[model samples]
Target: MKRIDVTRNWQGSRLDRFVRAHIPGTPFGVIQILLRKGLIYLNGERASGAARVKGGDVVSIDIAESDEASPPPATKPKRGPGKRAVKLPAAGAAAAARKKLRPAAVIGRDIRVLHEDDDVLVLDKPAGVVVQPGNRAERGSLLDSLEEYRRRSARTRPRGGAAAADAAPETIEEPPFPYTPVHRLDRDTSGTLVVAKTRPAARALARAFARRAVHKIYLAVVEGVPAEEE
Candidate 1:
């Protein structure tokens, strides 16, 4: 059994959907079965799939890791010389395609923080790093880097002695989902990205975006000249 804390990123998400996002390659039917068996728990209590999860909630998933791994795709020989065609399962194929979009491993320092506060974190996202996980298991995203930075900050934070005692309690407390992208930039697009640190902030930002209250301006550079009315 594994326990996953509900972060602001997944706040207000349905239990089943939350589990689905966290546990990839697992069939939906299996999740239902687990729920029926009371193998899944929310805050140490049996929960339904339709229940909503909030930040700071603890979810316990009692599922075997083997069940999470999908069988390998089948392969067949093609008509061409020394060529073969592989048949991938629908879910597995999609997951594989998503995984292919990820770049090489990235460290926390790669992401630049433009602005940070209790409610939001703005970053200068670099080209080639994804905004979030393409798949549940895939990493090397801006979100991952933010988490890494949070972890590093926690490790370096003052501990013990009078200096530590004088530190703010909130600083020493475990952060709940340090970053949740309210908007997304393409993996190849390097630009300013806004992330929410609290669920209320996330909701407000989402509403603002939905209402088109936020304005965005983009700049592009081209090296070659275009043809003259060709």
Candidate 2:
């Protein structure tokens, strides 16, 4: 059996995602099956994959280290720095192949990145770019460029387990390119948009949008200008 302690970084995150984080390279379907079989528990009770976990909670998984289905590569976090590094699965040739197939509008495109942090990424999306993939769209999307940007960033940063132990133990490292668009602008509209780097941040931003707490302003370019009073 393996155990994990929930921290504030994981608060409000889906239980299934949390589990997947610990066990790298595990498929989502496998995680769901474990949850359904009651092999995974939260605070000693069987919990659904969608259950939200908060700080100070304990999660237990009833899988053997030596089992054929499970591997021993899972790193056990120690109480101090300089622990074993967590290995993120390498980006394979498939990713490169996909990038090659993307349109020029996406590949090597200059995205006007406004701001970025551990929680969110802000971008000034260009007018001709789509926010996400669609059946009818022919060109590339803002998200495709975002993924490429993330890949570049990942190359510069140290993997989570090593960095966390050496610098800030409390930091919960996000997966590479896990960013998701919280909201979107029309393809023809050019404006700033925010993308969530983590699930908790995504949920918070979603709530803010749902409650209309976020304010928006639009601008337009016209051929002629009218009187200020009119």
Candidate 3:
């Protein structure tokens, strides 16, 4: 039995949907066949098509040796500033610099900050709030708020150091300003979210999740009653 640990990023989706997303290039009919053969298990129990998953559930599926061929690696985004203008402080004066470097305005009308620290920010995203901006016609998003957070964070740091000064003007670099997401909650599901302020922290959190070191609990309302244990 091949095992794969699920992450918080996979929460709120159906078991079938999650399987399809992770096992790329496999046909839907193949997945259905695996399910019928008792090859897929959710938390050590048989899973059905309709089973809804939470963040920490374990999903295991058996794959034949013919299917073990490796997929191509995903490409990383380009480095450098990408020609975008960095909002400069006014007049090159200290006071003017401080005033000009203020954080961007918060968007996403429904989002609220739950907790904040020098290394992270936690927000209670409302059910309908979108985390990132969409098409040109669409209005308000979480990315706007994150940009504001980044700007504010950048303004507070000293103007020295190789990584800090050499970092892309448009965005912060690793260690100090890595701009990473530790985990993500669904846009429609409102709950706690953890954002990493630095690259090392982000990597650490990712490893923790992969190792199943993080634990999560959820409250759900079901429509049926429990059967007695015989």
* Candidate numbers sorted by lDDT from highest down: 1, 2, 3
Off by over 4 Å in 1: 1-109, 155-175, 227-230
lDDT tens digits by residue: candidate 1, 58-121: 9998767434443334344344775333221232332343355355233474766655555666
Alpha-carbon RMSD, each predicted model? 24.1, 19.8, 14.3
What C-alpha lDDT do the candidate models reach, one value each?
A: 0.70, 0.70, 0.61
Q: What is the TM-score of each candidate against the true structure?
A: 0.43, 0.44, 0.41
Tell me the spans in candidate 2 whose CA falls farther than 4 Å from its real position.
1-108, 136-139, 160-177, 225-230
After best superposition, candidate 2 residue 221: deviation in angstroms? 1.5
- Please give the distance, in angstroms, between residue 147's alpha carbon in candidate 3 and its true position after superposition: 1.1
Ranking by TM-score: 2, 1, 3
**Pairing residues by index, what is the TM-score of model 1?**
0.43
Worst lDDT 10-window in candidate 1: 85-94
